[model samples]
Target: MPRVLHTAQALVDVILEIDELPPRGGNANARSERWYAGGAVTTLIAAARTGAEAVHGGAHGTGPHGDLIREALARDGVILSDEIRPDVDTGYCTVLLEPSAERTFLTVYGAERQITAESLATLAPQPGDLVCISGYSLFEPTRDPLLEFLETLPEGVDVVLDPGDPFADFPRELQRRVLARTTVWTSNADEARALTDLDDLEDTPEAIRRRLAPGAAVVVRDGDRGCLVFHHGRGTQIPAFPQKAVDTNGAGDTHTGVMLAERALGADWESAATRANAAAGIAVTRHGTESAPTRAEVDEFLA
Candidate 1:
């Protein structure tokens, strides 16, 4: 089995359920809790749960939050060998969940922003490994390191780029560079629009895939509308299973992790996306990112 290497931000997420979002300076009654997972770590956990040998390449801190991150990853069977700064604290984010299951996030960069190119080079991923790069790590400090790492990837290695929300204004050069090396690119509808600058948000998956890397497989997720997958010059739109949505925090991460796991298990692109859509459909029906469904749940959902 190919090892899945994930290079991105890992943080401690503080989730809050609120009756209503505060209007600008206005305050509201918001119920909040904390979770010890974010971004790449969250995806790595999902991937490991699916029987993948997952390794996390990122930075954390020596603080309590950092310890929590390590414990959580260790429990999930994720190999963590990246550096952690003693002075800096682990990154954190605040998730505000509304009644409609819509969520808004305010994040703070901590030691995760300190992941350097030199540190990433130590991973030494060989050909056939799957490298997962999160878009949130494309900011100022981590951008150069990520670019350097991507450029040095060996041939035959499959690269999966999931640029999450922070990369809306990512530079064209970096975007092109990353996309050029990407074998699979996954993004939500808003992210697809931001990356492609498409006027019609509801364009076909084939059209969106064309706008992206010409030869790479693309998966554009349309929330409850389902996900459209384009690969091998073919397009398939998989409808999302209707379920009572609780929170959509890590649904995209679940989809990406499951797709990569399927690919590693020798499934074709279409079949992988089919399984991924099912996994994510089951994910959003629950609250919190870490509450993603198990492999049995996914299999049952597909059945």
Candidate 2:
């Protein structure tokens, strides 16, 4: 199996359910609450289920919440590195879920945010491997080290970058450096607009393609409507699989994970996107980050 290296952190998410978002100085009662293993693990699970070897290339956390992540990854059969941090406990995110299932997040950074060069070196990406990086790691504390890591990546590995909501307006120069090394760039519609300074960016995938690093593909995901992929000057709109969505948290992660795994195995763009679409469709119907479908589940959904 081909390898998709995820140099992302494992976060323990505390979920709180509320009726609606309240105004300033207002309070909302919780409908429910629980903890789950979230963050980049969703994408890795989706990719691993699709038959690629999933690797945790960064320092897996330690201590209380970190233990939960470790156990979940073990149960899911994800491969971990020796980069486990003993110096600090894991970080966590407080996710607020509304009645409509839309979410608002407040995070507390812990050990997961720290990425050392030595930890990254253990993965040793090579030709035919796929790398998973997010703009979250590029923002502040980890920016300099992460940049150093990206610059030193083995030439032939296909690098895939996803700029989560937090990275909507990432610095142009850093974005350019990442684009230069990225094989495929994935982002949400709002993120696309914010990053490109084009309010109507979705109208043309060409603009994204033109601004991308050489030989890279631009993938802009439009929730429910589907995702658009631009490569070699051609645009392909891969429609989302229709489903009654209950929660939207891990859906995009599932899609990116499945697509990256499929691409790593040499699958064509359309086919990869379609399968990823199905995986996300199944994910939304269920609850939580670990809800991403298995390979058999995705096949059955397609069938």
Judged by lDDT against the true structure, how good is candidate 1?
0.79
Q: Candidate 1: where are CA atoms >4 Å away?
A: 166-168, 199-214
lDDT tens readout by residue for model 1, 139-173: 78888888888888878777888877766676767
Worst 10-residue lDDT window, candidate 2: 200-209
Task: Find the 10 residues in a row with the least total lDDT in model 1.
Answer: 204-213
For 213-258, candidate 2 gives per-residue lDDT tens digits of 6777888888788888888888889998888888888889989989
RMSD vs true structure, all candidates: 1.9, 1.5
Q: Estimate each model's TM-score.
A: 0.93, 0.95
Candidate no. 1 TM-score:
0.93
- What TM-score would you give candidate 2 relative to the actual structure? 0.95
Clash pairs, model 2 backbone: none
